[model samples]
Target: MVIVLDFGGQYNQLIARRVRECNVYCEVLPYTTSLDRIREIAPKGIIFTGGPASVYAPDAPSIDPGIFSLGIPVLGICYGCQLMTYLLGGTVSKAPVREYGRTEITVSDSSNLFKEVTTNTICWMSHTDYIEKPAAGFTVVASSDSCPIAAIENTERNLYGVQFHPEVVHTPEGTKMLHNFLYRVCNCNGDWVMSSFAEEAVANLKAKIGDKKVLCALSGGVDSSVAAVMISKAVGKQLTCIFVDHGLLRKNEGDEVEEIFTKQFDVNFVRVNAQQRFYDKLAGVCEPEQKRKIIGEEFIRVFEEEAKKIGTVDFLVQGTIYPDVIESGLGKSAVIKSHHNVGGLPDYVDFKEIIEPLRNLFKDEVRKVGLELGIPEKLVFRQPFPGPGLAIRIIGDVTPEKIAILQDADYIYREEIAKAGLDRSIGQYFAVLTNLRSVGVMGDERTYDYTIALRAVTTTDFMTAEFAELPWELLGRISNRIVNEVKHVNRICYDITGKPPATIEWE
Candidate 1:
């Protein structure tokens, strides 16, 4: 197994994803993990993830210097590289020009670290400091125009460092670089796969929750669904899944999820209809982040009340994935969106422990695990829905009338997409109920109704998404059906905004 020391970089989990993509088992641990724990895991190699801090910062994270002397191969990335250099008697200083995007690098040495690396290659660099010179026993492997010491290596000790990120998609050869390090330097057998993950996860779950009652918060999303199935398999009837339908879900989603959990799966499933409770709490709330926080806190309260009715549960299982954990700034990443599941557990919960089975896996990886756990393909590959449900999709105050209109429109859009055999092609496609209205003449009559926005994005990893170029005919069909069938929405417009400029959801 390989271990990644996370230093709070955004791509820290991506490094684990790439390593798993190579069929090499790996997990990311905190940077402050002691050397004793590193020796206990006995990983084939160690990867230090990039961080958003300079090595010289007063409170910057640092690893024990004894890690390098353990005879295990070590690869340090952006901030990791600088930390390694600073600890090994090398110099790293602030660069005159900060590098943020793609840059060209020329390979000076071609053997160990740069096996298939071309002489001139493009790399993704995001750093404010650069190594002025290599550490005492290291040799410079590659250099770029903006940064002099782009890559450094010490063959004798099997230590390597790179100033650029090889995990992000910005670098074309990023995966290849990581592959070389995995196979050539670390000597990993490439033995890890989803099947192996399932076997280990089941075993770990059994060990963790031995005959203890565990209640899972199933949201029917890939993450929660996979977690529910996994825990059920581990401790049969000891696991109970309580799905909270808080009125903000998509059209008929509550009933659909209930049918599956109750009829399809053998796990003990409880469907709680708390729609009125959410409606009362979110009556006047309009701010997006505030809506998320309130929904998160309310979900916990509902779950605790249900647990009390069902006796006592020792653990609370959540489908908190790696992206949610990282983006919640659990490992020092900047707060992107305050995912409702990550940090909103109230202090008054009955469960003493929170078990997140898929915490280390990404979205795509979660789907893979879901399939491995024998879950239905349709449910496993379902489009990712936020924990806040349609609450975040609505621009302003949420109402039952607005929800019914949006639900019909969204259902029409999804049904048409499936009919066109484009359900799997588009990564995520949904309809948003914009709280704006436009006046239009329909059959010689002036109609002023709410406008609906259609958003479709085509992406592999959801980190960076591009707007899907849906055919004009399909868009016209969706628009016509919503306007003709749905009463409140008379106008529809396709959102052509990319993820960088505009998030997937408008609210």
Candidate 2:
């Protein structure tokens, strides 16, 4: 296994995901992790994640210099590279020109890190500082036009550093470079698989939850469903799954979720139809973060109320994945958005503890574990849905009227995408009920109604995504059907913005 020392970098989890792709398990630990803890884990290799800090700053994050002499293979990226150089008595200062996107770099093929990577290749660079000189006994293995000493390696010490990021998709051969580091440099066996994770997780959960009642917030989506099944397998009837229908779900989703969990699973299943409870709380709220917090708090309150009827529940479970944690400002990363389960939890909770079994796994990895647990293929491959459900999908204050309109429009959009034989290929597709309204000539009469925005993206990992380019014919059909079939929708717009520019949900 490899351990990624996180220095508040946004891509810390992404680095671990890339390492796991090589069939090697990896975990991300904070930069403040002590040297003794690293030795206790005894990882085959160590990775330093990039952060938004200049190493020379007085308050910049730093590690113990003795970490270099531990005889473990270490790889540093971006800020990590500069920190490594600065700590090793090398020169690191601001570059003449800051590189923030894709750039071409020339590499020394002789270096083990670039074993199969091309000599001249494209890499993603996001740094203001550059390495001016290599440390003693370290060789400059890669360099770009604007920045010198783009990569450094101390062969005898098994240390490597790259000024550019190798975990992002913009770097075409980034995976190959990481694969080489994991197998060639670290000598990892690459024997880890999803099955191993499932077996280990069940055993650990059983030991931790002995003779205790567990309550799961099951949303019937892939993540929550997988978590529920895994917990049931561990404690059997001791686990109770509470499915909350907050009136913000897609068309018929609440009923569909109830039917599956109550009949299929052996655990104690309870469905709470608290539509009016949430509607009253969010009567006039418009801010996205506030809406998330209200809904999240309401969810906990509902669970607490349900737990009282069943006596005492020692633990509360949420289906929180890695993206939820990272997007909600994990470690040092900036908060892209606050996920209900992560950043939106209230200060006080009724449960003795909250357990998130799938917290470290990504969306795709969670699906793999779902399959390993023998969950039905239909449930395992269900589209990813947020814990906040359709509340965030609605742009402004959420009302029952807006919820109905959005659900109808979104169902039509999904139906057409699947009918066009593109549903499985697209990573995520949905519709947003924009607050904006416009005038239109419908049936030869002037009318004003809400506009629905459609979003679809293609991505292997949810971290970064590109807007999907649907054929014009298909897009036209979807737009035409949505306006004609869904009431209160006068216009349809397709969102061409990707993840960086716009999140998948409107709110």
Compared with the true structure, what per-residue lDDT tens digits does model 1 show for residues 1-507? 899898888787789889999999888887878899999999999999998888888998998899999999999999999999999989989999889999999976464777877778899999999898778999888887778789999989999999999998888888888888899999999988888888899999999999899988787777888899999889988889888888887777788777877776778998889998988888988899999888888887887788788876799888888777767664444567866563366666677888989888888888899888888887887877887889888888888888889889999999999999999999899989987999987888999999999999988767668999988999999999999999978899999988887877777
Q: List per-prediction Cα lDDT, in the order shown.
A: 0.86, 0.87
- The number of the candidate with the highest TM-score is 1
Could you estimate the TM-score for every candidate?
0.90, 0.89
lDDT per residue (tens digit) for residues 1-507 in model 2: 999998878788789999999999998877888899999999999999998899999999999999999999999999998999999999888877788998999999999999989999999999999898878889999998887788999999999999999999899999999999999999999988999999999999999999898988777788888999999889988999888788888898888777666776678999999999999999988898999888888887886677678876798888888777767864555678876652344444456898899998988899999999988776787777776788898888999999989898888888888899898899999998999999998999998999899899998766678999999999899899989998889998989999987776677
RMSD (CA, angstroms), candidate 2:
3.0
Q: Residue 18, candidate 2: how far off, in angstroms? A: 0.7
Candidate 1: TM-score?
0.90
Q: Write down the RMSD of all candidates, one decimal each.
A: 2.8, 3.0
Residues forming the 10-long window of minimal summed lDDT in candidate 1? 340-349
Candidate 2, position 235, lDDT:
93
**Clash pairs for candidate 1:** none
* Best candidate (score: lDDT): 2
User: Which ten-residue region of model 2 has the weakest summed lDDT?
Assistant: 341-350
